[model samples]
Target: MYEEDAQLASQDWSLHPLGELPGVDSVTYGIVTPGPHQPAGVPLLQAGDIVGGVVDQSTPRMIDAAVHRRHQRTSLIAGDLVVVLVGRIGDAAVVGVEQHGWNAARSVGVVRFTEAGQQHGISMWLKWWLKMPEARSRYLESSAGSAHSTLTISTLTQLPVPLPPLGFRTRLLRTMRLVERRMVLNTRIAACAMKLADAHFVRCVEENKEAPRPAAVIADVGEVVGGMRRSAAIEDGLPVAWAAPAEVLRHRLAHLDRTDQTTWAPPHAVCAPGTILVAPRPGGVETVVSRIPLVPGRGMLALRVERETDRMWLLHELRSRSKELVSTAQGQQGREMSRKAFSRFTVAWPDSAQVREPFARIAVPLHERANTALEENRVLEALITTEFTEMAEQTKGKR
Candidate 1:
């Protein structure tokens, strides 16, 4: 345990096992070993559903009502706090009114708070508390299972929770709420910026849909090359930005701060600005093209466009048609679109400079603005994290 947390533990604040919280109606894991998902039925919330201290219902898997009923113990309701007990461990989010009918997956532990007026404040505090770095470390330490770390219901039940005085709790909740609201607002702004950029890109493509198409293959416009495959034992190398498929999927660039040096790639392997880094075999092939340039690592491919093409337009076009390419990929275990396959793929290239230039002028700025918004959100997130750490330290000092 952290020294600060230990100090807090000795304070006058009451301590209770998580399961002993006053309003907790039920504490249980979700459906155990659920079967294959269906198209339409009860929405199943997984760990991925919990993002930024709220349940995102934007994308959810479906299971039949019978399956949902079988897991009635984990049936979610508004104000219920869902904690991830496996994989991600202690990440948590509150089930909002919109997510009331959802049922969680086995990896998600549901805590339903029955107390009316006070439930919201307590639940919010718990959500933030669990997200703290020290709390997450404690959860991992207590976790069992060698193959994959897991928090069993019994173990979770015994987890310690500090209960400060009602007045202190209210004040702390207010401060946390203010920070949370700003964070959420920043996220929403970033999302809106990206959406606007996407809309503009789609509009540009649609407007030029009827223009005379020039015959060209992907190879004609760019150099498609595979990424470096480093040996597992090789570690010593100059630090360089290395990006995997996951980073590309997030539409973010990899940097020295975020990427570790497993091994360095050759100079040719380094991606230049305006390079299109594509993950042909991402878990979700529908969203494969990265909006940002990045150093592609193994299992990824880099495309450096040599021809005069609008980079943003090319990116959007490839994304728009990614599903088609994914369908043509030939791997049986994990589908991968090889360099050969990508190179041969044909695209309707707009040859007119007049048509392409205007599109680039408008689309580029929108995407740049979107990227700026995303960068701002990242800074805000870091600031909030630092603020939380400082607040925790202050609390310990006061005690």
Candidate 2:
């Protein structure tokens, strides 16, 4: 892709179409019809399942094994590179050995290249390449002019790829893997911290029910602020983030990725840092926490609280019992949340003097721990791009 440089004028690198590369097999999308969801069935990975640059197995939907068997042609094999095709285009993650038998939805592309190319590790390099900004730009360019942006299989097959010398490619990816491993370790730590906090929240709720206490409505702790309809004009603002729906539903992490931020339209009403938002996803509305300054944009409703300490409790109330939360709102707001519907929802609150404050002491630190890990991962993500791009520019001479 850097062939435009004057120094590379005499370089003999090949820029072959991805499908034409020696190591690539068929590069294609996943199952078109997944049938109905089955509670006990084979997991079907969707674009939504590729969160924070990995295939999060826990977040995928389940389809009958029969449906999965019918879509065997697109079955995910261990080491295959899964690429998001519909939304958040160009997100890619290698299928780990644990995900070998899963099937993917039509919105995800399944690419398998067992380390083949002009070099020994082209598949690994290409997997990381697809996650790079430069490659994302190409994917966006290819999807131009559609009613909705989407990466067609034809464009991906024809996408150009470099054939760097083995030594440079190996050394570059070797360093990259070390950095990536640390990111993943941090991700696991954050996940564990969240799980522990959730467990504590559950225990406290159970213990509170043992004693007869006055009932409480959601309004006791927080206010349900409605969403603002955002437009393209928002891009002119100083601090902006990904569209609300994309930020909330695209991933299953406790913290949102800061690298995805962009300048958007100025806000008439900005939600506080610890506001808890309930937004509509594929099935129903779910809770998401935003640590950064945020505006409650379309398809999102924020639970603005007086104290930041109350956030952890309120977040779990909406998140852990979200099905119950959505059910309460369904009679009034349907699947979407409304102030009227949210007003009627009730949650068991512990006495502030005892349970609530102590839980906060434990939960707040865990939330901070997760935020710290995700923030560091963002820095490492930037470091990866810088190191890889710099190495790529000097690769020709190295070879």
Candidate 3:
């Protein structure tokens, strides 16, 4: 490897191989086949299970204990850092107390730590280290070298771990915890706001007795447009934000403030603020309203709702019927929602503006509240990454 290719840290600290770290007991991948999800079974954490730097155990894929037994090597304990080896490769989340004894899916790699490691917070530091911008870029670069873009367990085991002095590492992590706590608080606030909006929508729907009418071009709404595919050539100069299907499907939030991918796109691809974005998931369509103007990537469609008040009403309308949106899908997989399918999907749109106004009055503030929390998180995430980079820089080339 070239000197520049190395993930550098201070010369004062020795770089240890991840698998050989004093705290890490073993490094291994999860089960090859978990079979179908079942009730009253062991919860299995997949690559997608890690969200926002934590394990989202709310709706984990439950597999038979028989299946889990075969993968006893990957059974998780509190503070064991789980890393994604496939789709969303390189993402890491520390196993929490709630998910103790749960197994992992095929695409996930479990880094089991010695009891001493857990007490020393080694797993958590590694998890946060992997999330830094530089670390992520390096991992992405390494994974992109493969045709299938995967990070193997064997490869992960050999990863160089920067060994900062124990005292300094703990102190820095102590401060970083404060930032993480604030982030968790914001996430909770956003989640509560979202639930409130959903409740309001449900109440509004229950009380309404008006007949549903077709959405019109001028009266109530506009047309539904498909997202355009972008290439690397047009994105060589200034960066352009493009929301990919994963971003929408994974988040599935009420409103989107920023996008993940970057590429130049056509005018039609750029969705105006408040435009509803719909993307397909495993069993349903995931929808969110764009808070800023940005381009939508492949497998994404934007619904143009000109009226600000109408935007909130339609967002909940589409979200509530997300499962039904797949009825118009063309394939057996049922994971793609084309523009034709969604355009044909009947939304509970009222022909008169006054009808939607009542629901929007209650829903709009809730959406704004949720979005406000998301915005703060966006800022916090950026700041946290920046802080990580700065902290690392402090140790660079130091004696």
Candidate 4:
């Protein structure tokens, strides 16, 4: 049985340098002018084209026609393989069909299988080669400059591809394609959840815009507490939960919100449970609230809600209007949030403290649901990564 298998494999095997092979063509990298100097033309390949290892031609851009005549030979056809050379780096995709109007983006290459019979084999080969560890290392090694790193054609031409039997390559591609299809489905599902979260935020903001302001408020964040600082640990330390601004924004874990805070050493301020951990600096387009998560640290910054006040509702209020808090702190090096700035910030309170009760009813369940959905996405991402790693290893063995 072993001898028979060896002969069968031998019959199916072939080897050649990528350049020596006929029909395989490198991609055209060129510049296009927006004016009549180049009329709107061909479908261009972009770095973003390689999402989950497939070409997304859905958002193809048109270049000036004059530019197409300049780089006429680099035309894309159905069998060509497109590989990214910069930015996102090394993502590969197959050209679906000949697109006359489209031009290729910078630092991208195409491999066209000359022989029709060999097209599938070559596409699979290029895709698998791009994913290999050697290819990625070479890509990183070849990147130029201290500024924005880039990979050139010379780097790709020198990449060593393991030559395996056509039968083995085909089998490997088949298995991976199946896994990819499932992963794509999961990705779309996660995207839907994100869309819902965005919509919820929009609705809350609109509703608040229409509501009236409260009469008198006790204190804003700055008056209640000061900044927390922590140090890095070499090995181990007490179970002090350390949080960055990101965690706070993500969980929206108002006063009583809980999360597994990573531990750190001294110098880092201890965030006691109930303290509103805010991001010192806000980002992009109107400094909306920092995307910081308020953690129920081990008793730090706990809220002292009055008899009729709902702490959970207050957390949601802070979260929904985080952008405003961020905007108020704009200035002073665009860095840390000044405690003084936070202290003077105005919060609109409802006419009656009884408003907090109804607010909690809406806030608590939504908060829990958001946390559950986020956890699910994390788990799914991990599962996909593990499956891809194991499959790559198995395929490497076949080679």
Candidate number of the best TM-score: 3
Q: What residue runs in model 4 are displaced by over 4 Å at the alpha carbon?
A: 1-17, 21-23, 32-43, 55-61, 97-100, 115-118, 144-146, 204-210, 213-399
Scored by lDDT, the top model is: 3
Cα lDDT tens digits for candidate 2, 184-214:
9999989898898899988888877768665
Model 4, residue 205: displacement in angstroms?
A: 4.5
Return the TM-score for candidate 3, rounded to 2 decimals.
Answer: 0.87
Q: What range of 10 consecutive residues in model 1 has the weakest lDDT sum?
A: 252-261
lDDT of 4 by residue, 279-325 (tens): 53335111111122332222122233433234454444555565666
lDDT of 4 at 327: 51
TM-score of 2: 0.83
Error of 1 at 12 (Å): 4.3
Between prediction 1 and prediction 4, the one with superior TM-score is 1
RMSD of 2: 4.9
Provide backbone clash counts, one per model: 0, 4, 0, 32
Residue by residue across 291-343, what tens digits does model 1's lDDT show?
33346676667777653345655666676776666743556644454778778
Q: Lowest summed-lDDT stretch of 10 residues in model 4?
A: 284-293
Give candidate 1's TM-score.
Answer: 0.75
Error of 4 at 112 (Å): 2.6
Instruction: Give the deviation of candidate 3 from the true structure as CA RMSD.
Output: 4.8
Q: How does candidate 2 score on lDDT? A: 0.72
